[model samples]
Structure formats: structure tokens, C-alpha cells
Target: MKVYKGIGVSPGIAIGKVYVYSHKYVNARPEKISSVKAELKKFEAALKTSKRQIKKLSAKISRHLKKEDSKIIAIQMHFLEDEVFVEKVTRAINGGKSAVESVREVLQEYEEMLLKSEDEYFKDRSLDIKDVGYRIISNILGIKNELEFIDKDVILVANDLTPSDTALLDKSKVLGIVTDSGGLTSHTAILARALGIPAIIGLKDFSLNVREGDEVIIDSENATVILNPDDTTKAYYLGKKQEYEDRKKEILALKDIKAITRDGVSVTIDANIGAPEEVTKAIEYGAEGIGLFRTEFLYINRFELPSEEEQFEAYSYVVKAMKGKPVVIRTFDIGGDKDFPYLGLKKESNPYLGMRGLRFSLANIPMFITQLKAILRASAYGPVSILFPMVSDVKEVIKSKDILQQVKDELIQERRDFDKDVKIGIMIEVPSTALTVENFIGIADFFSIGTNDLTQYTLAVDRSNENVADYYIPLHPSVIKLIGMVQEVAKKNGKKLSLCGELAAFKEGIPVLLKQGIRVYSMSPASIPEVKKYIREITLEGKNIPDGFHQGEVDGGL
Candidate 1:
């Protein structure tokens, strides 16, 4: 009957036994070796074996994932090729330590160095170092790693999951993912969503109390996990699970149908995707367009910045695949949880309010130019729009448009074909921006409300923190008021407005947004069918939500 609350990144229900995955690295005892050459040879052989294992794992990933998507596994390959890392291990071995002991010691030093750094890039890279280090040690010790031991259906619990660890997950066997350390925007969360698995994260110390084979119930909709539920509770949740599945099937069957209300008001239903692989699911879910294509995925989880050609290829793939459905490609919204080392950006104490979104793009013109050129070039394939994220000022929009014009001029000089009429938009996630929506209507072509950040900044809460997840209400009166203001301005100006945040697909909030005159909605692909079904039932022809909602309600359900 013990209940633990967490944030659900993916939506679903799972009733299964717990499989606590250990994050312990192999412990190699300090041992003196007489032959330094033999020890070095053994270490080299282990490194080679580790590389082969990574290659094999990458191949397995490639079968189901695109080559670019599979590149996450290459992080390990780069580590294996690091001459300095190899030299450190060799020096330790030459100092009378065994191959296993030397490898373990050197890896610990490297991990400590990264962990001590203030920069988040180095801190995140420590995970990659740990992933590759574990593989190498496992090869030397001739033992199976934790991932290789997932042999049955279970709720996989861990302290955290690395990018490589998540990429190798066998979705059929891993029923759901529960982690002690992770946020809504973590790599594990992103991978779980992409794999369509039920996930609950930031359950601080939840993994410590669970044992293998413990009965677990994960209700992702409410972000709840029950450990060893009572008979009555189990039965209740079992029935709920069945009802959810039945309802899901019923809604999913109407995927291809238009998202029109019973009163005949039609609204665009788009999807917000993080990667190219998700485009398939978006199309399958009957998305009218791509409301938010998070381009930051191209930069993160890699060692270096993505070249313009790479960016262009990725944007082009999605544009061409949509076959003319409008795609709004958001420029790199890097900062906060997604900082890259190559960018050389300073680490700030408060990243959410720091240089992020359009601010980051403006600071680095070359990088900004590269991305704009890619998005513009991709527009030639189909209808494309460039979206600037986290915009708080009208000047940011004007400056972004100015840079866009510069890129278009460069393209013209280079004789490259692109859509000259490609639309430029800004995300009104900041409260100040929403308050001054009229000022931006003249500069930006369109607007999309990123309710996630808007709620976070407006309410002075970090939505990613599970401690305050209770207080991070999306339907708060202030947030809704901001939405209404933006919608009113956009409507008066005859500019297209969309909501591309989690609130867009919220069942209760949909009616409120409709009342605000927001006609376009974008959310995760899995939510589209259910949201569309909910929309179909609503006959909002001169209807209003409850009086409290219209008159500044606080916490009660809409």
C-alpha cells in the first residue's frame, strides 16, 4: 500500500515485478603484476573487446533506429580511442598494477575529474565515461553487465540511466522505467517516451526500498508508483488498467479522422517531436503539422557540434517525410538540461532564466547562421517554418529575423534554392512576452505558447523538480490569463497561434484553451488520438468552462 510519487515522462500503466538494476561498477582489487607488458597487453585486448561489443550493440540499435539515432553508441567508441585515457591506464599498469586494477583506477580518476567540474557538459560526459568504463571492466572480468541480465518482463528501476544504457533497452522485456534520479527532460525520459514505455522519474530514494520480484504498479497518468499494493487496491488498478487500454484502442481507431468538434469547429492537431525517428509516430497519429520540432536533439548526446549539412539533412528528412505538412523547426533551445561542451558557454547558477533559446542563438551568430541556413534549405522540400524558443523581447524576434535575412542572402549568393517566404515565429513562454504580445505581433509571423516554461517562469517553479511537481499546476489562473492575452492579440492581428506544450493536450485544459481562441495545438504524438477524441465530444458552440475557470479559478479541476 506504500505510494511513491514521481513525474511521468511517458504515459501508460504497468503492473509487474520490480527488477532493480544495480549501477555498481566492477571492483578490481589492487594486485601487483610482474610482467608490465603482459598487463598492458591484457588491457589492450579488453579495450578491443569493449569496442567490438559497442559496435555490436550499435548494429542492433541500427536495425530499429536510424544511423544518426544510433550514433549515441559512438560515444563509447570515441572514449575507447582516446589516447590520453589509454596512456593513463598504461602508466598505471607499468607502475606494478594489474590490468583490471589500472583500468579501474584510471577510470575513477577521470570520473572524479568530470564530476568536480562546474560545467554541466563535463558532468554529463561523466556518465558516458562510466558507461564505457563499465563495458571495459566487464570485458576484462568476463562477466555479464546489468543490461544483459534483463531476461523477463519487469519494471526496470535504477539510480539513473545513461544514453548508451537507454539505447540498448529491449522494449518488449522492459515494461516500464522508474529511476531515482531523472527529470522530465532527461535523456532517459526522452528515450522512454520515444520507445513508448511507461516511465516515472525523480522518485528520490524510491529505488533503494524496492527489492527484486516486488509487486509494482505504475500509474503514469497520475505519476504514481505503488509498491506491494493490497489485494483490493491491486484489483482496482487492474480494472483501471484494462479500462485505460480499452479506451486507448477506441480512441486510436479514430486516428485518421479529422479533429473537429461536434459543433463543426476544426482545429489543427500537431505533434512536438524531439527527433526524426518520432516523425513516423507523429504521422501515424494523424498530426496535421509539426508544431514544435525540438532541434536541440541534434546537438546533445554527441561529442561535437552537428555540422550544417547534418542539420540540413535531418531537417530535410522530416520536411520531405511530411510530404507538405507544415513543420515548425525550433532553433536550438540549448541551456538548462541540454548544454553542449563545444559551445563553450559558461555555466550559470540559474540556467532557466539565463542565456537560453533565442538568447543563446543571438550570442553565437555563426551557430545561429548555420541552423537558420539549414532550416531555410529544408524549406525547399516542403512547407517549413523557423521557430525561436524562449523569447521574452520583441527585439529578439527582430534580431532573429534580421539574421535569417542574412542567411537567405548568403543562400541567394550561393545559388541555393530555399523558400523565400518561409515564416518566422517566436515562442511566447515568458510572462513578459505574453503581457506584451501586441508588441511582438508586428514583428513575428506567428506565435506558439510553450506552456511548460510559461507555467514554470510565471509561477516561479521549476517543472522538472519532483519536490514541487504538486505545485506545478498548468491550469493555474495566471497561466490561463496569459494564454488568453496572447490568443486575443494573435487573433486580432490575424496571425496563426498555437499551443505546443503539455497543456495543449490536457483533457480538462483543452476547453479552456478553445475558449481563449487558440485554434492550433501541439503535444506528444501518443496524446493526439485521445485529445482528438476528447475534442470530438466537446460542442463548444457558445459554451464556457465552469464560472470559476472563467473568473480566475486556482487549483480545482477545470
Candidate 2:
């Protein structure tokens, strides 16, 4: 058996035959056309066909997704009809270029203009634009758009997957995913997590080393893939798979039960979700509430900021879906290595420490006010909490709350409805904030430690950088100590403290967190079962858990 290690962004286990995926794209050469009218007509036809296909595809996707989540497809379709892009193609064709050639050149030029940014997010947008370009150009050229060789129940091995490619995936047949490139924050990783598929990315040589029909074991827990395993090796992984399923069964049995120890101490068990569709999965997995609703999904990869109604619609969907359970919606945490080109955010050398999170929002007051107003409107539906990210001090929190108040005032003047008493919170991620938690006690309603950024900021380690990924340890003693401090402060002030990061989802780290007096664990939807199972196990045994965790008889039930 051959083994490959990758970054496990999504958790699960899959034992299946490998189905390697390859993309066949046609590069359009600059072809001079004899008739500008003919070429323009061809371009128009391609645009029409692309729109038809996009709408058809959007309808298909909407069947599996909510309207709020399917808006990206609509946005892509609108981009196809954007007059600026179409005019560029028209001018190129009028200059004696074929329709395909015009599309290829104009889109390439547009994409290249954005690709010049050093920021990763803008670079990512360039890929998205390129995807849109390919969709239209390929429609014009009559090239097959979907992955051609997908077979049922097969683990897909690919060099890398683009957003367009990920969007077109056949969910039923594609049992698991393995990609050679992409980090934990990559678009592919986010989509994989949303799909709840077992995925391991950043395996640079995986596709090259594996062949089709190879029996593969995807142990995403350990980020290892076993290729062409012999009987003994296969048996080991098969047993692991069974154990995983059994544990899931046991955890699901407790899904209806409150997330509490046998001693009857309750802790909030929530799911951190990126999209509206994940809310159903979170609820199915017994998530009491959404700990983190990353609002960036509604804001990214576009040339315009989302409107107040659009933001309200997205938030209201999640807020309403939770059915009165408290949903914590995070403000736009972009910048800090993430970018929104539409905002005209200038390129910065060190984006991580630059205008990001509350700072960026503070600078863009109009956008900030728009989001705050939308969130407030959504809060009227059910219990909602607003969280600000990358808060270094009380001033940012005070300022944000002030703007929120202004929005509320405007809403009141306009005689609009809103939750006047919505809870306000800040991420206790920075070291200074962790130490100075008391200063923020009265001003904020709660504190949620974003361990991913906390670890990154605390240790000065770029967690997304693969070369130094090993250094970005969530289990580091220093990280645990900082969390312990935050927990102490939260407890002292009678404020609820929740952890919503990669650490909370980690099986091993759960015990560590539980021991640190941290009770709330918010993770990905798929992680709820295992993390809950581990909590149950330790608390049942009265083993490493805190005092009063085990109060009743333990069972070897499942």
C-alpha cells in the first residue's frame, strides 16, 4: 500500500475505488474573421446558450440548495450579460477576431488585470472570472462543461478543482474528494465542507501517484489516503471505517439529548456554517444553534456590495431556519489576506495586520451600516447575535456598536422592525483581547474565541501557509493557556464563552478545551457527531473531564 498525506479540511472516511479526474480545455488561438457580422452573431448565440445553460444549471442546483445560496449562479449568469464584458467581446470581434478568440482575449485581459494583485483573495477572484470566461467560451465552442468520467461511488482524484468545477459536481456519485492543491481556506475546501464530503487537499503528487480503479482508503481524520491497499491494510481501514460509522450512530443517538455531562451541566453545542444550506445539516446533526454564520459567502467574488435586502434575505433564511435558536452571525471578516475587489480596497503588503474585519468595516462606514441594518432586520425573525471579528480593543467594539445604533436609529425613523436588544459579541482571538477580556465585559454580550486566527496572531504563524503549517498547532500549550485565560474572564463576568474554530472541531483538542473550563464547542456540521461522541466518552468515564462531568452509570452501549 502507498500512502499520501494531505490537509484534512473536511472530516469523514471513505473506502472506494479511485476515479481520477482530468480537465480537457481548448485554448482559443486568435483567429481573424472575414465577417464581423457573422462573428458578432456567433458571439450573441453563445451568450444566449450560456445563459440558457446557466439558468438550467441554476434550477438544478436550486433543487439541492436554497435560493440564497443559489444566488451565486444567478450572479454568474448576470456577469455573462454584463454590458462591459459583452462590449469588450463585441469590439474585439469587430476588429476581425472570431467570437471564441474575442472572448478568450477580453476575458484573459480582464482576469490578468486582477491577477496582478499580491493578495490571495483577489487572485482567487481572477480564477472565478476565468471560470465565467471559460463557461461562455466553452459554450461557444461546444465543449463539454461537466466532468466527463465520473462513475458512481468513486473517490475523485484530481490535480485541483476550480469553483466552477466544484459547482458542477455530481453529489450522489462522487463519494469522496482528493485534490493535489488547495489549502484549508481555499474555495474548494469551503465547497467540500458545505457538501459534507470526505475531502483531503494539498496532496501535491496524489493524482500523479494514483491510477483509476485503485482501491483507496480516505481516512480524512488523519489526512491520509492509502492507495492500492493489500488485504491486511484494507482490513485495517475497513475496521476504522466501521468504527467511525458506529461512533456516528452512537452520537446521533445523543443528538436529541442536550449537550451536557452526566452531571447535568449544559454546554451549547453549535455548528459553524458558511452557507444557508448547511443550516439543515447542522440541525440534523443536533446543533443547538449556529455558532458562526460566515457572512462572507454573500459578499465575495462580486463587483458590487450586497444590498441591504439581499443581506437581510440571506441572514433571515438562517435565522428563520434555526426556528428560534440563537444564531450568531459574523460580520464581514474579509481582508487579512482576503479581498473584495468591488470595494476598491487597495493592495497592501501585509494585509493580515492591515484594514480587515472591524477596521475595514469601520473605514467603509456605509457598507458597515448596510450590513448592520440588515442584520438588525433579520434579528426580528428570531434570536440573533451579531459578532465582530479581529477586534483588538474596546474602541473597535464601541465604534461598531455605535454604528449599529445609528442603523437602528435610521430603522426607527423609517418605522422598520428590528430586534432592539440583539446580543453583541466580539471574537476574543487576539492576545491583547484575551488578556483584556474584562474591559469588554459590559460592552459585549458574549465572547467566542476564534482559535484559528488566535493561534495565527498569537504565534505569528500563517496557518494557511503549507510550508509552515505544522507550526500552526491548535493544541499548542500556549494556545490552550490563552483560551484558559479567556474562559476565566468570561466565567468571572457571567458571560457565555464559546469556541468556534478548527480547535473546537478537533477530537483530541476537545478534551483539552473541556479541561480548560471551555464548554461550548462549535464546529463544522460533520464534526458534531464525533466531537460529541468523544465528549460523551470522556464524561462517561469520569476520566480527563473536569469535576462533576460524570454523574451516572457508564455504558458500553454502542
Candidate 3:
């Protein structure tokens, strides 16, 4: 009769027996020594085998679920092949430990760090390493570790589920998901949404408290999980479940409807995506175009920069799929918070302000132009435009366009077909850049206000620093004034302005933003329907915006 409240990352309901899944402690530090080369070879073979298995699982899951939910397997496979991880395992083996013993030792270091990390995102990442470690060690020992579904429907309770674990799960038998740790951006939440299952995350200790086969009701809509509920509560949830299903049907009906405001103002809503596969999900959710195709994923999950042809294939896939629905692709916004160790990027004391985004690209011009060439080549296929991130001045914009033009000249000599009219744009993220938007607006064809970084830099608060998290307010008066200024100038100069940050998804500040004349909104796929519906119901009605918008409580979206 106990009720536990958690963050509802996915919406729906499921009634099932509890199936608690946990990994057994592996203390297999062998007392005797084994041949280093033989053991190393054995570990290598197992690692190779695990890579194949993960690839197969990814392929199978992509066929059933949306491709975005299944892309994590590729990331794990990258870890399996990472030179650092490989060298560490080799070093451990050379230090006179058996294959299983050495592998466990090296992975345990990472597992412990993640479990001990103060940052919530880093702490949740332990689940991924542990899941992969289990696979590799089990492969070496010839052991099989997987979720065993009981004879009836069940809800999975775990500290957290990795993309590998969640991807291979028996979707038909497992009715819902409950996890001890994760956030809205976690893969567990994204996978659950893509799978259309009810899920609750950041449950704290329900995995430890809940028992096997105990009847439970997972109410994701209300973010509640009830254990051994009384008859009355069980009946109430069952009726509530029916109502949710009915509402889902109604929401789906509005998918093809236009996302126009109540005053008959037509607004364009697009989806921010990671991989090209996610473009399908965006279009399926009624995204008119790809607003922000983040190119960091191409660099993150690989050993080296993707070649021009490889990058071209990926970009062309989305460009063609949208069927002339203008795709705005942002170049590799890596380095700052998004680390690519294989690239040999120097360690910085203050990475957020150091080498990152457009700054990183400027330093590595050869690699930068390679990616630009690919995007330009893909532009020939369909509607495509390039957007730059972390831009601080008009000079960087001119320099980047100069390099792009240089590449275009080279492509012309080689007789390559590309859109000579590909548009160039910059993200207004830095406080200085936002304050002086008029200086850069003339050269840029369009602008997207990256509210995430704008809020961080404007308030001089590190969003990742938990101690100062309260100061990172998106609705602060200065932040609003900056955005208002950008909106006013972009309008007066006849330049198109859009909000592509996480703030675009939430409706809490919709009234304030609409009055600012932000007609273009881009967000995640799951947000499209809700945002579209909210936009249609509300109109500015010439409401006056408060001067000090930061007076009340504000929860930042992105």
C-alpha cells in the first residue's frame, strides 16, 4: 500500500508483476597466473565477439523500434574499439592478471568513478559501463547474462538500464520500466518514449525495496508507482489507464493538423535531431523540417573524423527524406562539453570558455573544411543549410564562409554538383554576440537563439555546477531583455529568427515568447504534439510582458 513518486519521463500506464534485475558480484580474481598472450588473445576474441553481438542487436532493434532508441549500441561498440580502453586492458594483462581478472579490474575503475560522481549525468553513466563490462567478461567466461522474463507480464526494476540492456529487452513481455536513476535526457527515457511504453526514472531506491512478482501499477502520467496496492487503488488505476489510451488516440489524430496559432498565425515547427535516422521520427511526429541536426554524434561515436563521402551519405539521407522540407544542419559543435578524446584535444582548465564549437573548428581548418565540403555536397540533393555554433563575432562568420567558398571552388574544379546557394547562419549563444546581433545579422542569412548557452553566459553561471544551479535562470530579466532585443533587431532588419534550444519545447513561457515575435519553434519529437496543441490554444491578445520577468520561480528547460 506504499506509493512512490518519481519523474515521469514517458507517459502511459502498465499493471504487472515486478521483475527485479541485478548483476551478481564478480570477484573472479584468480589465484594462479596464466599465459599473458593466450589470455590476451582470449580477451581480444571475446571483445570482438561482443562487438558483433551489439551490432546485431542494434540492427534488430532498429527494425522494431525507432532508430534513435537503438543508436546507443554503436556508441558502446565504439567504446569496445577505443584505443584507450584497449591499451588499458592490455596493460592490465601484462601486469600478470588473467583475461577475466584484468578486464574486470580496468572496468571496475570506471564503474566506481561513475557511481561516485557528484554530477547526476556522470553518475547515471555507470549503468552503461557496467552493462558493457558484463557482456565482455561474460563472453570471456562463457557465461550468458540477460533479462529473464517470467511467465507473465512484468515491470522491470533496476538501478538503471543501459542502451544495450534496454535494446535487447523482450518488449512484448515487459510491460513497463522503472529505474533508480536517470533524467529526461537519459537514454532510458528516450528509449521508453520511442518504444511507446510507460516508464518512471530517478526512483531513488525502488529497485532495492520492490520484490519479485509483487503486483504493481506503474502510473507514468502521474509519475507514481504503487506496490501491493489495495483493491480500491488498483481499480482506480485500471480506469485511469483506459483514459490515457483514449487521450493518446486523440493526440495522434492531431498529428497531421497544422500547428497554427489561435489568431490564425501560421508558425513552423521542426525537430532537433542527432542522427539521420531520427529524421524519420521527426517527420512522423509532423516536423515540417529538421531545425537542428546536431553533427556532434558523427565525431563522438568514432575513432576519427568521418570522411567526406561517409558524411555526405549521412547528410543526404536526411536532406532527401524531408522532401524539400528545408533541413538546417549545424556543424560539429564538439570540444567544450562534448569531448572527443581520439582527436587528441588538449585538456583545458575551463573547457566551456576554452577551445569549443566554432573556436575549435577555426583551429582545425583542414578537418573543418572536410565536413563543410560534405554538407555542401549534400546540399545538392535537397534543401540544406549550414549553421555554426558558439559564434562570438562577425569575423568568424566571414572566415567560415570564406573557407566554405574555397571548398566550393575546389569542388567545382573536380566537377562536383552542389548547391551554390547553400545558406550560412550563426547561433546567438554568447552574451556578447546576443548584445550585438545587429553587427552579424547582415552577413548571416538567418539566426537561431541558443537559449541554453545564452542563459549560462548571460548569468555567468555554470549550469553543470550543482552549487550554483539556482542562479542559472532562463527567465531572468537580463536574459529576457537580451532575447527581446535580438527579436526586435532581427525583425527590423528583415532577418528570420528562431528559437531552437530546449526552451522551445516547454509551454510555460509560451505567452512571453509569442509576444516577442518568435514564430519558428524547434524541439524534440515527443514535444511536437504538445507544443503544437498549446500554440493553437493560446494567443498573445496583446498581453503586456512584465519588466522584471525573473521575479518569480523559473525552471530552465534546456
Candidate 4:
């Protein structure tokens, strides 16, 4: 057995064959061509060949993978047919460049354009285009470019992997992944995490330094990888692997079990989903409902905002897929850090405090109402709830509610069936909402604490800003005190309070939150089993009364 070490990103163990991705480009010099027309003819042929190859790959992807897995390939198919890209290559070839030279020149130009972009999403998207281009060129040259599987237990390494590459990976055979580039929020890292594969990224020069088929051991929890391990290290990893497998089996057994405490206190374990296909995964992971269905994805990677019919189709699918499960759809919270190219939102000087959340919704009332109407219509098919983001005060909540009422009234006047009684709630993130909790208690149906933003706002530190990220602690005394206060207010008014934040998913934070009288903990579906396990382990000895607050009157239920 040979091992090669690289970064370990996500935490999970797998044993799969090594499938290395390599691309081969054709080298053809047009300098020997007697006429520019000949060079142009060659370029046209290359373009045709590239298009055919992309179509073939796309067909293969659709045939072999799930519908969700083939989405990225479908997007790439559009790029392959882009007129500008084709025109650029043709122009370069007309200039008497070789086929390889023309393709490379056009790709370089596009890459440079994308590299100059200020938006990270667009910059990353450019990388996808480059990868597609390289793959097309490689296919044109008749290169047998595919991942190589040499071992039963293999660790896949790459300089950087695209979403398509990650999707194409044979998860059944691939054990772990290590890459030289990508951040925690990068698509490659997110995909690896979703697939439950141990992954490590952002290691400098890993591809250049690591050799193929070298023996490796990956410690995913700590993001460590050991190359060509010694006997002692090998033995240590074997023990660790056994522990992991045992724990995994234990978790798997609890998959169908309800998330009820030992004392019979039932907590709703809902999943936070982004895409329609994720609804199935949520159900498979034993999620009782969809707590937070982000709608921003509909606006991303597109040329315009999704039409009402389009939005209805997507929302309807998710609601129908959930069967009878409650699906809480959050209104579009775009602007600030999240931009829509079609919306023409300029870069903000201070995005976190700029036009975002409720502010953006209020400013674009028509857009907000359109989504509200669609969501309400979908609610008729299943249990659906509307969640508004960034509610700092009761006035904003009132305004949003007023708009929702208007949409419902209009729908009723038109004799359209709509869920007029759909539950309306606010995301209690800003400190103002926590400070003046009573004003919002009766007005809103429930409160979903977005701790990621609450902590950032309370600490006056940007969570995305690494410089002061340490100060943005969800468990800080101030933050804990505020959460305690909010929970107390919710209890006093007989309202439901749940947390749909990163903090709720943390093992340490869950115990503390539960002790503070938090009943519902919403998190990523993948985290359901572990959170449920922790809840089951809570004994009387482990329970502690929260400081600086009383439980007040417990009333109302989800």
C-alpha cells in the first residue's frame, strides 16, 4: 500500500480507488499553414470538436449521475456554446495562430478578465470556464484523460477541484481528498463536506510536492495528513479508524429515531436547505421539516431575477417533495455582501450595515411581494411558513406583514387560492430585536435567531473579516445574555423560539442553549444525528439553569 499526504478538509472516512484528473491539449502550429484561411478552417474544426465533446460529456454526466449532480455540467454546456468565447478563438486563429495557441490565447484573455473581477463568486466561476476549456482541448487531442484508480483505499489530490469535478468523483471508491487551494466556503469544500468525505484544502504546493501512489494517513478533524507513515503512525491511525467506524455505525442506527430527549422533551430537528433537490437529502437525513429555505440561489449564476412562474415551479417542487413537512421559506436577503449582477447593485462601502435584509425588501416591495405571493400559493399544497430576514424592530416587521397582507388580499380578489393563515416570523439577528423583544413577541408568529449575524452585530465585528473574527463569538457573555433575554421574552408571550444558526449546530453550544430553555435547534441536515445524540445524552446532572433569567410561562407549540 502506498500513501500520499495532502490537506484533510471535512471529517469522514472512505476507502476508494485513486482517480486522477488529467487534461491533454493538442499542439498544432499554424505557422506552417500557407494561408490564413487554412488556420481559420482548423479553428472552426477545433470549435466543432469542442462542442461535440462537451455534449458527449454532458450526456454521460446525465446518464451516470443523479439530477442534482448533473446541474453543473448543464451550466458548462452553456459556456461551451457561448458566442463570445467562440468568436474570440476564431479571431485568434484568423490572426495565423495555431489551434492550441488560439484556444490558449482566448482562454488566457477570458481568465485575465475574470481574475480582474472584484466579486469572489464571479472569480471562482471563471475557474470553472478554464477547467472546461482545458477538458475540451484535452478531448480534442484524443488523450485518455480520466481519474486513475490504482488502490482500493485512495486519497484523491488536486491543485484545485471544480464543482463538476467533485460531482463526477466516484464517492463509493474515493476515500478522502486533499487540495492545494480552496477555502471553507468554496464550492469544492462545500461539496466534499456534503458528500461526507474527509477533505483538506489550502495547502500550498501540495500538487507539486506530493507524489502519486504514496502511502498517506489523513486526520480530518484536525486537518492533518501524514505521508509515507511509519509503523507507529500507521498503528495509531488504525485505532482511530476503528473508533470512527464504530461511532458512524452508532449514528446510523439513530437515523430513523425521533429527536426526543430522554425525558420525552421533543425538539424539532429541521434542515436548512438551499436547493430543491436538497429537500430529498433532508428527508433522508431524518429531518422533520425544512426550517430555512434560502431563496437567493434562484438569482445566482443567471442573467436576471427568476420570474414568478419560475419561482413558483422551484418552490412548489420543494414543498411537494417535503410531503407533509413544514417548509419555511426565507425572503430574498440579497444586497450588501451578497450581490445580484442583474440587480445592478453597486459595491457598498459598508455592506453589513448597508441596504440588506428588511431594508432591501422594503425598498423593493414589488419584488418582495412577488415572492411572498408565490410562497403563499405553494403553502396551499403543504405546510409552509414565511420567514423575513433581519428584523431590527417591530415597525419593520409590521411593514413586511402589511405587504404580505396586501399580497394575500390581491390574490383573494383575483379568486386565487392562497394560504392567508401562513405563519409569518422574523429572524432575530440585530441587537435591537433582542433588546426590545416584547414589542415583537406578539406581532411575529415565532423567532428564529440567526446567531451568525447576531454575534457579528452584537460584537461589532464582521464575522467574515478574519482580522477581528475572533471577537465575533456566539458564546460571549453579552451574546449569551441577549439570547437568554430573548428566550425569556418568547416564553413570557407564549411564542416559539428556535435557532437556525451555526451556533445551534455546535455540540458545545447546543447543550448550553438547551439549558437556557431553547427547545428547537435548526441546523444543516448532515448535523442532525450528532445533535440528536447530544440531546439524548443530557442527564439531570448535566442540566443547569441559565444565569440572569427565569423560564417564565411556557405556552404555545410548533
Give each prediction's root-mean-square deviation over alpha carbons.
4.2, 5.2, 4.9, 5.5
> Model 2, 1-558: lDDT tens per residue?
888898776667888988887655554453567689988887898889878877877776666554455555765776788899999899988887888888888888877986797665556556556667777777766778557446478898988776667767777877789999775555576667657678898899889988889888888877898888899988887897787777667666767666666555566789887777779888988888999998876766456888999899889999999999989999988787677667778878888888888888899899888899999999989999999998998989988888888899999999989899999999887899988888998899999999988888889998667688778888888889999988988898899889988777665676678768888878877667555555655663445554322111100000
Decreasing lDDT order of the candidates: 1, 3, 2, 4
Runs in model 1 deviating more than 4 A are: 23-32, 66-69, 113-125, 146-153, 160-174, 185-196, 541-558
Q: For candidate 4, write residues 468-541 as lDDT tens digits.
A: 75677778988888999999999988888888877877655766787688888777766777667666666434
lDDT per residue for candidate 3 within 396-441, as digits (tens), equals 8899989998999999998999999998888999989998999986
- Residue 486, candidate 4: alpha-carbon lDDT: 93
Angstrom error at residue 431, model 4: 2.1
Residue-wise C-alpha lDDT for candidate 1, range 1-558, written one tens digit per residue: 699988777778899999888756544453467699988888899999988888887777666564555666787788799999899999988888888887778888878976776544456567767788777777776767677667899899998887767877889999999999765545676578667788898798998999999999998878899999999999999998897778777877988888787788898899887788779878998888899999987876676888999999999999999999999999999886566766778979988889988898899999999999999999999999989998988788888888899999999999999999999898898999999989987788999998988998899997656568688989999999999988888888999999977688676788878878888998877778777777777778546333211111011110
Query: What's the count of clashing pairs in each model shown?
Result: 0, 0, 0, 19
TM-score winner between 1 and 4, please give it: 1
Q: Which of 3 and 4 is the better model by lDDT?
A: 3
The candidate 3 region of ten consecutive residues with least summed lDDT is 547-556
How high is the lDDT of residue 108 in model 1?
84
Judge candidate 3 at residue 530 and give its lDDT.
61
Question: By TM-score, is 2 or 4 better?
Answer: 4
In model 2, which residue pairs have backbone atoms overlapping below 3 Å?
A: none
Candidate 3 segments whose C-alpha is farther than 4 A from its true place: 1-11, 25-56, 65-71, 74-99, 109-129, 139-143, 182-190, 213-240, 464-472, 542-558
